[model samples]
Target chain A: MSKPAIAIDMGGTRIKIGIVKDNVILVSASIDADSGNGLRNRLPDIEKIVKDLMNGQKLTPEDIAGLGIASPGIIDTNEKKILSIDKKFGDAPEIDMEEWCQQAFGLSFCIENDARAALLGEWKYGKAKNYDNAVLMTLGTGVGSAAVMEGHLLRGKHFTAGILGGHFIINYKGETCNCGNKGCVETEASTWKLPSIAKEYSSFSDTKIAHVSPIDYELIFKLAGEGDFAAMEIRDQSLQAWAACAINLIHAYDPEILVLTGGIMASSSYIIPYIRQQVENHAWTPWGKVKIEEAEFPASAALYGMAYLVNSVG
Target chain B: MSKPAIAIDMGGTRIKIGIVKDNVILVSASIDADSGNGLRNRLPDIEKIVKDLMNGQKLTPEDIAGLGIASPGIIDTNEKKILSIDKKFGDAPEIDMEEWCQQAFGLSFCIENDARAALLGEWKYGKAKNYDNAVLMTLGTGVGSAAVMEGHLLRGKHFTAGILGGHFIINYKGETCNCGNKGCVETEASTWKLPSIAKEYSSFSDTKIAHVSPIDYELIFKLAGEGDFAAMEIRDQSLQAWAACAINLIHAYDPEILVLTGGIMASSSYIIPYIRQQVENHAWTPWGKVKIEEAEFPASAALYGMAYLVNSVG
Candidate 1:
């Protein structure tokens, strides 16, 4: 019986904190995140939540093996530093996460990019268990990606390799991405771009979904299912953008299995078959078909992943 | 001191053969390749050329350390076999190259994708010498690419990693590529697709280039220099596509140096600055600027590359 580990999965809208052991989440909780305000102010709340979760589970800080965080930005695992800032966590680069964890819980610490952490979780305990070459794409607030090649995680010289899938330019003349690239997949298909993309339809104002505030993929899928013209068009374009992104990933990394995760996958019933068909028609894999599967633990994969990392290091 | 090794670089239209030692080409020759007829029939001609070159240098078969080939298509170096067929080398997969080399010269033989060969050449003796992470893009009849990440060649599960730069889709709604992907950089910019892409312009028939047979990038650059409208449009589109491909490569494999090779780079005076500006404006590299340089040996890098591989393994 190994000691339980504390894991934090930071997202743009919410922060999920969990206590996990042996591939299971013993306890978990989430709080709304005001990402624009930055992560520094949220440390106290995270600490409190972790303590309360541990207490409810009848445990103490001493019972934990280590602490791990899956943050949404470019991370340097060896140096335990955030290399780049995402829109969600603007002040993340300045915070010394290792030191904070040390002073707070007195536990050993490890950190990785949230997408890469999720991949590690899947690679260790989920759908990617048997494959040596795998790619994970998290379709959420922003599209995040991570790849494993020949059983080794592909972290390049700057620690940015295999994590820029959403940033790939799929439409040269399309919209500009926040990352400065033009026509990136994220600029066309992600949640942040959904409203703008939907408004581009001339009939958008006449549609049933037009008045909805904070429109999401789920709503679009529902309206499209109900046969609304604007919704159907938006849904089709988004699907193609995702399919193009998938083909690009397949060509870029040559992974044996591509695992799709994140919130958008809640509509995998419609997304999977469509993307798989497009891949079948377009992807140029001569060796064999790349297996496309949904991640087993879409929401908690990052928690499991961070726990795995912390446990291994501890 | 190492013995001179034989190198063969196979292209769609021509074959470049050379004897190399200490990074110098002792003797070299070229022969037009009727690739449609397959590599099996070309073996006799290649053998004769090798013998003649060696005789002129006063060297016997035993004087050579080994033989290496840089051929177009996906190659499995471990099996010393061609795994996929390219339009250039349609019958390459069926040819037992190692066995043929053994029967012909009683020398150890190795083969690699030509783009990877060129990259190795650049990495060992050319512009990429000091950088541990580097990417090489070869723009010719087709755009080809290979990458070195963290001081290792990125050969993925199917031996196709880092070699699909041209196949990346930059215009998802654009023309279908020979590789079956839609709107690939190659479909928009490569020499093989040049005629079709040019014809898509309404004024193509009225331009000075209308009468030219088998139009190439050089003529387009020359005409564009003279302010020909159709030529200028074609040139600009090609440059942008190449720039997008460059950014894709940088984002995909975080390289310190990007070496641009191939015949199209003959106009590096125009291509380099334009691409540098676009990369500066669009690439998301926060760490620093990625240096872009022309290949030191655009025509003969693969010759040097194969020689290095053969000598090292010999």
Candidate 2:
């Protein structure tokens, strides 16, 4: 039997830590990240929390094989540095995370981008175990994606190749992308950017959505289900954007299956069929239709992926 | 030294034939394809032309190793059938192209999709030489592309893989693609669909482009270069579309190089730089910018690819 491992999922706000030998979680803990203070400044705080959690569970370093950290932004798996993080992780790129963990715990540590980690998780512990060619897309604040091609994570010559799925363009002239390009898919349809997009509609002031102080996809879907015209229009538009992004990935990567997840996936009952039908009608796959569906495990996918990736590395 | 081979590039309008070895065309011939009459009806005419060309040059079956046919549409290279063909070929998928050649001239035969052939051309003998990970995109009546990963064409389980680059969705609802989907890159940008797109632009009637009976990128670029406002707008928009498409390919297939070819490449002087700048500034390649450039030999890349492929099969 394989030994258990420590899995850590670090987000901007909080971190999820757990012990796992297989699919079953032995024990877990959550701690505030306080990411705004910079990684170096918060390193001691994180160490303390992790130490307390391990002691409370009566587990020692010898109990685990290694530690896996799933962080956001671009990861240089070669050097084990975060490298060019988003606004969220100030010292991520500069911080020696793997080395710090090694010195602190006298054990091995590894790092990976969260989306790829999630895909690894799904492939090992969730719905995509049988698929060798697949893509996992997280439609949360921004569209995030990772691809597996011919049983590889498709890291390519540079680690940047398979993970830029959200940056795929849905409209050539739709809206500007955060990466500074105009008309990227993420610009027109994402939770963080959707409210601004909704306001761009001519009837924003007259629409029911204008009355909501803080708008989101959930409210939009609910209002649209109740026949709010503006809400319905935006909802359809967002769906189309997501569907197009999916088809683009299918055409470009030729994946056998596509996994949709993230906070937006909670409403996947409405999103899945719509995307499947659109791809069936529009995507030019002469061989067969790309299978479309929801992700099996959400928050735990990346955590579990860490375990799979670490084991694979060995 | 490698033996010489004959390469034929079959198009709806014309056929380009040549004796090429190691990527250089020693001699060439061109004649109308006349494929509109249907394959069964046009076989004799095409056969005679090919025979006359080879015979006139004193080239014999003993002198040539094999003949590779770069046909338009889905080709099952292994099964040796067209697989999926359009109206131009009429019963092409059912035709025994290989058997016919064997009986007609005692020559070994093979076939590949024209786009994939072009990629093979660039990879083996043209600009993409020595680059194992790359993509060849031909922007013509419809966009066509093929990819090579770790030094091989990505022929998916069904042969549909790595050949649907043009069908990528650029708009979720921006335009209707002829494939029955809303907002495909082909619907919004390909030459076959551009005339109507320009007509719907609202300003077409007032712009100089309206006066041109056949509106195309050539006219658009020509007039735009001459300071025509409407043509300029359409040209910039198309450039942006192509740029977004480039990013889409880069993200989808983690290629180190992207080769742009086809008739539209006549505008590469402008297109390459625009895409390069856009990719440099906008794309999220954490490794570095995905190198973008024009197809080295344009229409000839496919023929070169054909020669190399045949030589390898032998």
lDDT top scorer: 1
RMSD of each: 1.4, 2.5
> Which clashing pairs does model 1 show?
none
Docking class of 2: medium
DockQ for each numbered candidate: 0.82, 0.61
TM-score of each: 0.97, 0.93
Model 1 over residues B1-314: C-alpha lDDT tens digits? 67899999998999999999857999999999899998998999999999899999999888998999998878888999888866766888988999999998898999999999999989999999989999999888999999998888888999889998999988988888888889999998999999988888898789988989789999999999999999999999899999999999998999999999998998999999999999889987878899999998888889888998888888
Each prediction's whole-model lDDT (CA): 0.90, 0.79
Residue B246's lDDT in candidate 1: 94
The most accurate candidate by TM-score is: 1
What fraction of the genuine interface contacts, i.e. the true contacts, does candidate 2 reproduce? 0.65
Location of the lowest summed lDDT over 10 successive residues in candidate 1 chain A = A83-92
Error (Å) of candidate 1 at residue A186 is 0.3
State each candidate's chain A TM-score: 0.97, 0.94
